[model samples]
Target: MKQARISTGTQDLPMRWWSDAKTPGAMIGGIVSNAFAAIGSNRQRSILTMLGIGIGVAAFIAIVTLSQGATDSFTSKLGFLAQTITVSRARNATNTSLTLSDRDVKILSQLQHVVAVSPTISDEAEVVFGKKHWSTTLSGVSFSYLQMQNVSIGSGAWWSSEEEQSRRHVVVLGTKVVENIFGQTGIDPIGQTVRIGAQLYHVIGVIEPDSLLGNDGIYVPYTAVYTPSKPNQIAQISIQVDGTDNLDTVQTEIQMRLGQLHHIATDGSGGFDVTEAIGQLKQTQQQLGMLSGFMSSIAVISLIVGGIGIMNIMLVSVTERTREIGLRSALGAPPSAIAVQFLLEALALSIISGGLGLGLGLLMGYGLSSLLNVSFIVNTSSFLIAFGVSTAIGVGFGLYPALRASRLDPIIALRSF
Candidate 1:
């Protein structure tokens, strides 16, 4: 009797293949089918690995986005606080001492492109309101100071030049000072008398809380505390230049005028220090850019690590599926087809993780902005770069493992399992 023969049709086998001249759709379908098959074989592991990539990418995006937003908000607040030229006495200068006098401010006011000049004098002192006492910065400034600093009186009016000339003691309190001294009680602190270092000052206004500068301050009229005969009178002078003119020329002219008034060297380095508010704004912006870049680098590191994790998992996948690869090779599936299938799977994982990460990152950024009372500024460039990098990482790291799978000897790979 002849030995019984068992036959299984090629179609009944676990793996299948198509002809070489197959249509484009069929080729693509085969790639997709293989990727889904791989994922389905180890659904939990694949999902867990992709989750790791998603988390890393999300963290990177959140940190960079938040940092950029915070930097922008901080710079904006600072810009608002200092909107014009700020001339202060430089603590150090070669030759004569750099001091800005009230006379210098008067001269600057008469110059072309000079909008307004405001002088300030400040000292730290204890303020007493009724039985309450608080430590505060006592600032004496001219009427134009409020306009120059863009400060607004939230409740009452600011002190006038007449009040300053008459030496009438009136004070403007910062929001925190008002809150700390008066609490939430319905009693109006305005029109109330407050004593500062043995002098009596009536509360004229309350300024809203400044976002950049911390609170606990009071503003008094410049003339209320100045003595013309006293040499060391004013602390600093703020000058507003014509917004229409060339700022460089205006700054140069202002410096030259200050040099002439103070009798110092005029080679751009005068006795008094002149700080252009616009220059400060630019510097702040540059610093913010650097900070954003640094934070973005940290995010990139996390993404790279996540990509490496994907590569390692893919290598393990190729090893585990060697028998399947060998079976497919035996069925006339080309090595390039095998490689494309694995590469497509890797790309799919990376693209999906990147998208999820970006969404989560944006959500986290908005959440942080809400919590911190700042704005959410999503950088489109950053999002695109992140997604591109993730995809590149997938292709770059996935290639070796995929090629290794495709190059496996069918006979050996089949027998090894």
Candidate 2:
């Protein structure tokens, strides 16, 4: 008898593309390698397709980080404003004689939690230094004014209390005044004599650049600006509190005390208005928050557009690999494997793109901070959110195309050119 031959039929052998002895790790390694290989095969198309996601991620990260940096800078730099209060005569006040005075200053100083008080008298005059004459505002204040406004003397010392009491004609020039009067001559402004109207005043100091209260005016003793006829009348009073915690209480006490001093009702009939700096700060922060939200919404729209781009490219990829998919199916690859391969390819693209975008965003945010003269800050949440969103977009947008590819009939797919 002839030797018995073993039949190799479909029913006799299992049609498994992967080996039964292969570990799950090996399967995962193979899938990942194949995904990278497919992406590498078309480098130019992959990079171009990645642009949409890259741009979206970059804009999102940059905007958020930059906004946060700016807000922090603002709060730190101007935070002192929150611990201060401003008292000004209301514009609607009919009594021109109801002016702030030394009495008001004394009362404000003695109030609970009050740290400092400085009265200001504002006027305008033509300042003449040699042939240079520039018209500017004049602020008449005491030595305590500089400390209260967080202003530092850039060049020379502030006038002494005796100089203020004697009503001496000494002036502290702001940066703008120096630029205009002494800029062309390159002259040292300190100890220089400048004429205000018909009177001459010595410049004792120069205000530092970017001073909150001294950028565009000249400062002198309040007694120098106020009429000798009206001894202690002042234009406004600036009050500093010990800390933020006492701001509301101090403001209320100030209003009540001033109302009593002026012999006016405490309601709305008072001649003066009290403005809490913290309120203005909160309003500004709210505006910034709103602006950040609007920009974030735009960034989200960009991400959605990028997701759509991902889906479009994935559908194109599936179509291009029709014959390959059919061949793999015919070779006993399961539909699940086909889906996983495509999905992995999409995920890989997004991961790479997100990384590139994150780097670009950091650079952009740093440049922005430098441009705005603020601090550069990196937020960890931004990185995590960016990467997480990118991965989600890949999976979400790539799923349909992957399923469609897996469902393609091998006979029909193979017929495609």
Candidate 3:
């Protein structure tokens, strides 16, 4: 007896999938297995395609992580300068004889937005402690210098105001200075006597190693360092403003005041220079941000190239499996099943690529952070976005090829070479 012929129409396609499965889960499993089998057939091409994605991801992650780490480090190291200004002898002044003095400090302190003023007298001196001697910077500062500079005392207390006022021979040592003199002898630095130049000064405190201003110097009363002939001579004056908004105003006021005091014109003829640290910090950060953006743009181009490669490869795959697709369609597989199989292959390729890219990116970030001496940070949002973008690329790029494969006429496909 002759059986009735089955219709291979679009309406009849959804009745079953790639296999004779009785349940939805089992049907899905069979489709997935077939998709992976197709991918496994061309192992070399698959890996090469994924390489583009991996490189793009690694570059993106490393650049962003390094950018953030550098910004954080700079902010921490120089954040204090945002509210401070410094006055020094102008290096480009026509009159090189001009110098700073205590008068500048008092005048700056009386300004409207001024919060604090501390003067510094810096010089290099041979420091001798017991059998060891080292030449380091000797900074003469006021009693308020430590607090103004945000310096922390490591082991001993900062000198008293009275001690500074009386011109006592007491000093605060930097961590480097202590290390050079005391070595690893386990000696208590406080109360130890160290000679600076020819004067014997007792160590009253040790500055924390991370102190920005006093990292490699010694601090003493400004009066103790003063020569009898130049009693008011000072190197620079550091002024703290009440807020960041008033930094420019205070800086201008200081320049005008210094010009008037020195009997010089205010038009770049003044003997002093005024610098806003915040301006320098902003400029540096802006340059860094631009560089990071440029690098990220290149990474984005890499991703686009990788996506194109995926589309090209998937199209080639569809062509290579034309006979198989026709056979499946003739054996009762639907266009939806054929489409799903191709789509799944693309997704599997991309998902695997993304996973590999993630690991490679982290390693690259870590190595870069170490080489650059910055912190290594893993941002969760960035990670999620990377993964999501990869998945989307898979679906978007693979859609056309999948559809073309599904829509093929089984009779035509079967007759083709």
Collision count for each candidate, in order: 1, 0, 0
Ranking by lDDT: 2, 3, 1
lDDT of each: 0.75, 0.83, 0.81
Off by over 4 Å in 2: 1-21, 91-97, 228-235, 267-269
Predicted candidate 2 versus true structure: per-residue lDDT over 1-417, tens digit per residue: 332221222111222224331777766776677677778877888898788888888988989888999899889878888888999888888876787787787788899899878888877788999899999998888777877777788999899879988989999998998999999898999999999988899999998887777478899987787774683357778899999888888888888888888877674255888998889999999998899889988987888888888788889889877877776677677899889988998889888998998899899989988998887889899999999989999999989988998999999977763
What's model 2's lDDT at 198?
Answer: 88
Cα lDDT, model 1, residue 320: 73
Error of 3 at 178 (Å): 2.1
TM-scores for candidates 1 onward, in order: 0.88, 0.89, 0.79
Query: For residues 320-412, what per-residue lDDT tens digits would candidate 1 score against the true structure?
Result: 777777777877888998898888778878888888988898888889888988768888886887688779877987898889889999998
lDDT per residue (tens digit) for residues 207-244 in model 3: 88777765688889887886646733687888989899
Look at candidate 2 and tell me the lDDT of residue 157: 83
